[model samples]
Target: MSKTAELLKGAAEGFPDEVVTQATVRHLDLPGGAGRFALITLDNGFDHTKPTTFGPQSLTNLDAAIDQVAAEAEAGEIVGVGLTGKPFIFAVGADLKGVEVLKRREDALTIGIGGHEVFKRLSALPVPTFAYYNGAAMGGGVEVGLHCTYRTVSRSIAAFALPEVFLGLVPGWGGCTLLPNLIGADRAVTVIIENALNQNRMLSGPKVYELGIADAIFEAADFLEQSLVWTSAVLRGEIEVVRQDPDRGEAWDQAVARGRAIADEKVHGAAPAAYRALDIISQVRNGDLREGFAAEDQALADLIMGDELRSGLYAFNLVQRRAKRPVGAPDKSLARKVSKVGIVGAGLMASQLALLFVRRLEVPVVLTDIDQERVDKGVGWVHEQIDMQLLKGRINQDKANRLKAAVTGSLDKAEAFSDADFVIEAVFEEMGVKQQVFAELEAVVPEHAILATNTSSLSVTEMASKLKHPERVVGFHFFNPVAVLPLLEIVRAEQTDDASLATAFSVAKSLKKSAVLVKDAPAFVVNRILTRFMGAVLGAIDEGTPVEVADRALAPLGLPMSPVVLLDLVGPAVAHHVAGTLHKAFPDRFGTSENLGRVVEAGKRTLYVYDSGTPELDPEVAALFKVGDTVLTEEQVRARALEAIAEEIGLMLDEGVVAEAQDIDLCLITGAGWPFHLGGITPYLDREGISERVVGRRFLPVGTAGVPE
Candidate 1:
């Protein structure tokens, strides 16, 4: 046996069930005078829910299958080789579970080299080759198709991407070398870098063909038959496959520059994979295939043993596991059935709730307001959103019509809540207003009906105290732009019953969101942490730091958006409100800033406004602050912010806001857009020594962030 095969076999012996996919070979007769061909199908012996992924044994099986095809070709038994996947799935890529188990340098090197050696065999075969992309193909899955001579894709196939950089690794299995040379460097940078950074945006099969990646596209029902016929014609010289010559001029240089700029802006250069990917693509214009492959092998082995990859994998596992299984949720059987939903107001937030309930729950949702005009406006807004979805091809005509017909509005609270099993209020943030809405709802709603509030920072207990059945009240806080953000923070009040909490979790799951169970503390989890962090920033401004300097100081922390940008996106008025509420709840630790109050009073929307794409301090907003001689440097500003966050998080843990530190990490990662490589705030604190300095102890154990001993 070959050395690569031996290494893979030894590794597979340790985890026999880890490698999930197996390759099966079948002989097929071809048209157009081509005698016969050997077809290989990749399947994991599971339903489409478990997509095929490669591990040591999986790659070994594929390697042996390729060898059989090569032997058949040499014996004059086949004219070509065709590769495809089982129904509804191509492959996702390498098995991350397998990579997570590697602890030795030799094991990492063996896996990396084994993959390149096996996949490179596709190009070495002395026969015509084709890849039939039947469904989703990502990372190494897409790289395998690049090794083929031609390709055909299925109409039903979507979610095609090269997402290695997003996972904190480069495309190590020959993708870095082959993609840029096959498609021009400009297009390669987009597929490999820009799309990966944008949360791994994917392309449909037709889009794949339009990008010159596929030679033909066919319907899913007859995809294999069409691909076989096309391959036969190509072998018989009856059809031609045309490809665009890669552009290797100034265009390539400019594309590389653009890719670097995007990586720097998005990740602030914290991700090493982005720069390594750029390095690989830039070398492709002047390097040979073998040299590029060797470079990838080295890069993959190095990254697999790095702290960034370890932290990223930890974060990935947390999202995949903890987000699906909420920490303190009650049994699923305890959830009440929600047949109808009611909203207490007909404003923008209420209308957004209506759209979400009608679309996800597919049930009747009614909105109530004080007058007829506002009620009509809210209902009209819901219809407009449904129409927009129809126009964007997100929903069919039938779905759009059904969703639009399911929404209604009323001026009478009694009429809206008469039959609603779940009623939520998205009214003003004031406790008195929320109390009044819930009191009115309690008078009309059924005894079994749930009362929910979408308050960002108010106390759920106070809002429910005025209700006749406070046990039915639960906090269902959702972030703004409800359609995009995936987090649904479910707060359980002191009087909240298990039935109501279970139903809230069930509803969040049905909406396809990551649910986090939080205590009924002021601002709950995300807002409490965010408000404390923002307080430090505003405090620095109050101490005479430049508005721009204070805003730019957190860039090194690698937050998804800058503090200033986030404040603008979430309106100055909302931030100020939340800060004031948090300050009231925790007066000793959290403080409200006078400068932010001044800016809100001036009616300024943003502290810095864009002038020709450059952010300049809005003179009007800047004038709202009184400058003194107590300015701090960027390093000092960052230190102050980290210290504040550390202190607040320690208090949250002490108060048992959530179950564990992992819960806080999951909440921040999902709701607050904390970077994955940082492994949430606690891990970042542990690594930076800030947790020890401020709180006199580390937030996590040693080596939690894969810090070398």
Candidate 2:
């Protein structure tokens, strides 16, 4: 294929670099004029047979390659493209390594916008384009399909939707436009918004089509042959053009109507975005696509470029990019296999992490705390879960016992860490205590242990400072209830060796966690940014603003829970601890206030009259805000909360506590109860420019430092 005259060879132009081909589709006119198309393949420039990415030329080469094919094909044609491999992926999506090129702005073209633009150009092609997706189609790779006239999926494809909205932008390309146009608005919005929320909601071919995005599906075994048959049909003009239902997707329209009614009835005095998206869909339903596409395009473009999108996209990207796998001794092949894992603490976090690790990796694990009492409690938890699974018939007793046996509790650290290839210490969030445990483990365990600490707000490097084997200390910062939270920060201290980092990545993979590599800075990634989020809520309280108002104001902004409720779940002590850590590490920037300390001293939990696990904004909370009787109606309170949250998010980015604008959204979505339909906090701010407007009306002016007392 590479030797083809104007086909694959010419596709390499402009790319000038080595490329990864993730998609391949070829069309042919048979002897009797029977058009034929065959397997689309995906292949990397590098041999993962060895541990490396594409050769120096990079993924840009593949983009250049595909661009060439699109150029040759007429408008809307599923441009013919192929890779070295067959029947899997024709080409993988954007080479994230391209981010390296993006960082040095003056050195090369801006990566994100440039890649976005490329996808848009592909979308303009007029012929019926079909991507026979075999494997994964992520980021840029999926963007290409947005341009295509059609999409077919092989059962092998682990379909997903993403725009890195949590990374500080929406799908900057036309994806935001194309998706809503392809699917109906509600489903597309759900896909994009949920991608920002969890990042792990896997959508398959039938699912994608059910969501109204995909065009067809084929068998994985015969996917190569089927893809070609479909492509040949395109060449022969036998397939129907992709078209929307005349009712403009009424099924989706009805769902939206039903959802809106539910939202209004159950979640009163809530923000309107979720309902608004449905409204927008309903409005667009009566119109032709031209009107709908234009509206969605401009709205999405403006939204992605907004504060919420920027903050959210940045934060999400940051969280996902850090895959700190433990590849010790540099042998590469068998770096961080994490065959068996050991948990040092079986408290809630420890138990949570244990369940998640087992759920993710299906690997055997040993969970231990200081005493049999706590151990029994933790083991009891596993038993309860296993029993539930047994009752649910999700697993039989034999399997239940196997899984139950897979998780055991103990008081012996030496025994736990000995056979275990990796260990994570999720003890209390104290540096000295973590160090003491590591020291003890080092004395009793094997020399090649990969020690991980699940301290959210502590410094990874500082934690390593007290260790004899400093290189082994890595921060495996997991959010509360590790079983539930998806993001894992792999904090890399200055002393952290590549081997240790690789081990963390290995463990993360075994545990099926999204491991992001972060510098050993204050709060690592998620908490550093989240600390600012909590502070914003507190800041609103300090400015004589009512807590009830602050809480309700953000309700409509699409957060899962209000800021106060989130704080209670986080535990005021832990929240304060992380705040103090970030403040101490980067004083002036992450500085804390008497307000936070006062909360701790005054014995105030996040909200008043806590309603057990999930906090409800009760009367006591209203009293805390001085809302006498009905001073401010629920509607008024929610409006103010939105304003206060926007202000503090702005402060975080300005203060540099959050390195990327999207980091705010990532933290909010994962840790801070961010609502998916509302896309995350930063996106809301950006879409409305509410940040700018809020500051103008209520907040201190942009350049001004503090709010008026």
Candidate 3:
């Protein structure tokens, strides 16, 4: 009935870019035994078409608002409090940038500013509070939900977790302790730690409740009403509280004992942290819950803020947000859908994409190659997915049969792509090979069909130049494990038309993967940045930094994997090929390292001999680089590496390989393992003011630095 309540209602209705300050206030109706509750929402309401999480100040303010509701409820002025948001979502998480931006400011971990205090305050509120997780509840969002006594969720595609560890921070609030208490210690630790490394590992509502993390799940039809109704039950004590804590102490000791034994049987050894995290949980399983939580919090906090977590979190978050913009697309209203797609090669990349098209769009997909066996093998892979999905209960037998019937395999271009609405060729990297494939595909497919080439490093425009319908050809570069990696780089070229561009986005969207548009240039954007980083790593070894030491130094920088290991994963041959390609494109920028080529040509695994376990300060590498037994300092290696990478990123930005500074960061996060805590190039520049100095020197040779924009 208050003016603030009226304003709150209006805010809850939703407005773009407006932050919601307060959602609810509850008050008693005279002696009638009824109460009125005030509820509202805060959102940017961006056209992104999904619920956005809290972005800084929002979560800090939200904690205060909850306190006011709790005060009013405890004063006996209101019988209940409520929360509401539409189209399925409760707060999924706090604004990620808010937490990350701390590094930019001195002492970002200042007491109240720590933000975890908000979660603790929410959990300690006296009056019963319930969370309505209408949709995906992410890091901070899930932490806040777990703070409430009773949690309800709509039967929607929503998940819950304390995933902060993935972003270089732990579930600072009591989530680390509360989750284990609510669920079993073993399950909670395993789930928490995995998410600590990767945010996408999901723990959903129905399962969370079954594991005792959430209190209830509701059908979407009346989710909010049901949540309100549940709160009343909790307040009246109709629902009994259950506490399940199995002794984790001895159990953890036994686990470590088991892990040590298992380590002997395994290649990677006992996964020390895996056993340790669970062991600590067992140590305090039945102890004073909050006290145990505080202890656990310190333990997790110590590991969470380390260089490893920081680097990993930065890259992980960066990838999720930045790596997903379309490199090019037609205006939404003019977008076209491809009814049939063509794959020019029956190789792994093409075949993987072929399977996704059939599984995702349910459209006709054809695979063609030089031989029947190769084509059949590609088609067989799709069929294998058909049988697997049928067994997984994701699709019924009937749908699987339909999917199987929709795919085609052939050696003849006319039969494979004659009716293709879009044609994507994944062939040998040679220009002649790509041109020949496109020339034939252009003849076989209709003029309206979009011509797409899966070329990682070649010029898209040149490939299209050989085709009569050059306007239809574009680059569609997908990362390996097409089903897993969520990025699809759509390379825009000079000749690609509006219709074709629109079709590319349509295809990417249908595949449920994020699209990033990049111009067709040497190594494109992602590889350009990676080339610099990997080049620096190899260079450091030659410069006497020691190979493993240089590689390990970059690891704390938060790459997805070690640099040398990445070379192995990419295959020595391909690394050499890509490096050679870039080196040819820009001699100074991509200059080859003789030491790197040595390993590539010979296929040598171990680069340098170092102490046991640690890969740093290798004496053998010193011998190769002409250094004595004196150890190579980590600082020299790291600084040189950072300078080199910063320069390459600057070149891409200067050349407009990607149009924006953020796009450069996205490429690193998504394609390479650029850490996101730096926010992007701009933020990194802001963080390391000397980054400009580094960029200035690196770009000097490429005619980029000191040149007028």
Candidate 4:
């Protein structure tokens, strides 16, 4: 047999459970008498909820289907060949479960070579091949379309992307090579590198067409019908399909350089996938498809056997599976329906909450404050956001009107919250202020109504201590940019009942957030861990380390942003407040920096200014620091910072702040925006031996986040 057949037989010997995507073919009568065309539909025998994925058997099925279509094309039995997918999905890519089971580099190489051998057949066929992107398409799914002669897309497909680099792997099948050849190198860099690094950003259907990835765009209602007609026109010589030649000179070099800069900024050279992908894309300027394919095969084999990809797969599973079903959550049946929501403050956080509730729950959200002016401003902000969504086509005009009408402002708390089933306070962070707001709200809202606190570091139990209905209270902490961040830390207070916790989880689900059940401890999971981390860096700076050196120390760790940049985002005042709270709780481990306090007192929001699109230490902020005679190198600073993090996570586990180390990692990944290659910090700590060195044990077992023995 051939090499591809040999690899397929090997893969089947110990294949993991895979949802095989069957390529079923049927003869279609081309429109306008263009002649018979073979159309292959990719389906995994599941609903849209379960997207189709290619496994060894699935690729073999497609290979067989291609054989049938190739025979038909050669005999002139069909004018053309076309491929599409079942409702709302094309494919998501390779079944990662299959990749996880590979025991040797040869097995990994099989996946790469086998996929290329099968997909490239479309381009090699006698008749032209067309791809219809009916719905969501990702890594391998998008690459398969690149192998076709022409492609069409549905306008309503929500996600279309090549997200391989984001998962610590290059698009090994054909993506990195064919994409730049199809579109220009700059646009390919945007899809493969920039978008993937930016939290795996997805392209909308229109964006795909605009990027020239799709030849024709159609409405989802009749996408297949339109695509068939378009294909017929092309085959009958009635429509001239045109494509621009890709730039292979200075422009291609510049695009490759830009991709490298993005990868360095995002991963800081810690992960190898993006660089490997860039190398493949750069070499494709030579216009050798076979060379590009061989490079992809090598990159895939190397990455598949590496630890970063293993960690990435681990993180992906945590976010995709564990996040959906939170640990120690109450039964869904116990969750009370939140028909109406109430906000006790009308500030920015409260306004964001109002918008989120109204848009997701489709319930009336009332924002009540001390005065009508603040309430009106908050309501107006929500209305403006809805209009912006309408302008962006995320919502229609009627939906925007409904969302605007659903959010209202009121000065009377009793009148606004009497019928509200859920009331959350976004008032001041002070305990007394929150207690008073909850107390006032307790009197107005129904006794069964849930009370949530948007407290970042303060104790949820103490905030509800004086209230008569403390059992109804829960901590509903959300990260800033509420609509963007996916994490929701659901804090269960000392007196918080199961039903209250359940209702908070239910609300989080409706808001499309990943909720982690955290204990009502000081600062809780993400904040507690992050404050300790920042405290270490700040402490190093206080000892006379240069701010830039201390900031760049964590670059090797591949954090989402430097601690200094994160401080700017979190605000100096807020970071100081959280640090002080943690220091008060754990004096030796969490030390508040005098310089940070000075910066906050000076009202400096950021230590660096970006007038030239790059951060430079601000003169005013630099003058506030009082450094010691001692200094440390970046390596020492990184060591201290990581040790502090490992110790804090150990203490948190001991204190039962969260159910397990996984929850802590989940919070850091989703809430704190930690890199996935780190496996949310613990796995990184475990791999680097920091967890054992500092905490006396590994946070995760061997092979859990590293290559198996």
Better model by TM-score, 1 or 2? 1
Candidate 2 least-lDDT 10 residues: 700-709
| Per-residue accuracy of model 1 over 1-709 as CA lDDT, tens digit each | 7776897887665343674789999998897668889999999898777879999888989999998999998898888888899888888888887776566666777777888888888888889889999988998889888888888999888789988887778888877899888878888888889998776779899888888888999999999999998888899888998787888899889999999998988889777888898998998887488888888888888887776776777777778898999999999999999999999899998899899999999999999998999999999999999999999998999999999999999888897789999999988889888888888889999999999999999989988887778999999998877877778899999999999999999999998888999888988888888888888888888888887888888888767888888888888899999998987888887887887888899888887789869777788887788867778888889998889999988888888888878888888887877877777788888888898999889878876656334
What are the Cα lDDT values of the candidates? 0.86, 0.57, 0.62, 0.91
**How many backbone clashes does every candidate have?**
0, 73, 17, 0
Compared with the true structure, the alpha-carbon lDDT of candidate 2 equals 0.57
Off by over 4 Å in 3: 1-18, 25-87, 95-132, 152-155, 218-241, 248-330, 540-546, 592-634, 678-686, 697-709
> 249-273, model 3: which lDDT tens digit per residue?
6664554354333322221221233
Measured against the true structure, the TM-scores of the candidates, in listed sequence, are: 0.96, 0.60, 0.76, 0.98
Ranking by lDDT: 4, 1, 3, 2
Cα error, candidate 1, residue 191 (Å) = 1.8
Model 3: weakest 10-residue lDDT segment is 700-709
* Tens digits of lDDT, candidate 2, 260-290: 6544432243433234344445555554434
The RMSD of every model to the true structure, in order and in angstroms, is 1.9, 9.6, 7.5, 1.4
